[model samples]
Target: MENFTEVLSKINTAKVIAPQIDYSDYVALDLSIDNEELAQSNLQNAKEYELYIQRFLDRNKAKIAFGGYLETRNLYQRSTVFKNLNSEERNIHIGLDLWINQTASIHAALDGTIHSFQNNTALGDYGPTIILAHHLEGFTFYSLYGHLSVDSITNKNVGDVIKQGQQIGNLGLPPINGDYAPHLHFQIILNIESNFGDYPGVCNAGKLDFYSNNCPNPNILLKIDNNT
Candidate 1:
């Protein structure tokens, strides 16, 4: 029997973002805690993030910036959901984030049925999110699309049959999209447990082992070169 990672490697998936943009146009973005540039610069708000992302894209000559699977970031410090006096700070991002200044079309990564959808309206939450259940090679897994536009989940229903590459929604703007710049937070989960439309996008250092195993790097399915 193969493990979840091995099983994921067997399938060829479609682009979760619009197909019009080629993978060659993608550039790796580092929001990790170690990024010196990000550390020196102050990126506290959505507008600031948008500006920072745009400058990076302009310099790299890329259409979209993607990365951040299992990367530790300091951007979540402003939200109480990520840290407080009581709970462990969850700064380690567990999903692949695709960033773009404009609102881009979001697509399904594979053929699957909608497991759940909800508008998580917390200060730094996934404003509108969708989760899909996929089955392959005797394994069942899930993909989450977060920071989506409100209309994305407006008419969507549970168990909605979604085809690979189908347009599910568009990237959302700030305040509505958890107060972040326009971006798609994509993650893969082996066991969703009792999670409905939302899942932990970040984890504390102590729980890193378990979360990493449950949520593998989304790049395994995206296959985009992690080149900056």
Candidate 2:
């Protein structure tokens, strides 16, 4: 059996957002615990966090801020959803986040069918989410789009076919999008197991190996060279 990375290389390079945005407009953002600016700021609320993101984009003269795959972030401390009673907190992000304006059109990375979707209503959750099942070279996998507006999943049914670059939905606002800054959390899952519309986008330190293997870096398909 081919490993996930090997199979991912065979898929076409994709752009999850609009094509008008130049690759030069994409800047790498760091929300990890080591980021001094994030540590000093008051980011407990979505609005404040949104402003922080705005400042970063403005300073860098970029339209989109990306990164966060497998990064350990301090932002998750605000939500208990990532914590276990006696276990290590899940601070490792497993998805690639693209920070952009609310209502920005989201695109499908490849041809797939709607596997599942739901509105996760928790304070810090996915809000409106969608999962698409895809196949390439006889191997099957799944793609997850989180932090989406309700309209994205509305009127859509399971098994709906989604073509590459198809408009899947729009980026959601705070409270509606798990109360965080507007962004799309895109993840690739090798085995969804029993997860439906939602899957663990963050993982505990000890389980990093497992999740990292199951969920490869989305950049493999996005092919985003943030340094540009």
Task: Name the candidate that leads on lDDT.
Answer: 1
**Most TM-score-accurate candidate:** 1
Per-residue lDDT of 18 in model 1: 67
Q: Write the per-residue lDDT of candidate 2 for residues 1-228, one digit (tens) a residue.
A: 876798787667558876668888999999998899898994888888889999999999999999999999878777878875876799999999999864588889999999999999888889999999998877789999999999999999999999988998988898999999999999999999998899999998899999999999998888787436
Off by over 4 Å in 2: 84-87
lDDT of 1: 0.92
Pairs that collide, model 2: 175-179
Q: By summed lDDT, which 10 consecutive residues of candidate 1 come out lowest? A: 219-228
Q: What total of clashing residue pairs does each candidate reach? A: 0, 1
Task: Report every candidate's CA lDDT.
Answer: 0.92, 0.89
Worst 10 residues of 2 by lDDT: 10-19
Off by over 4 Å in 1: 226-228
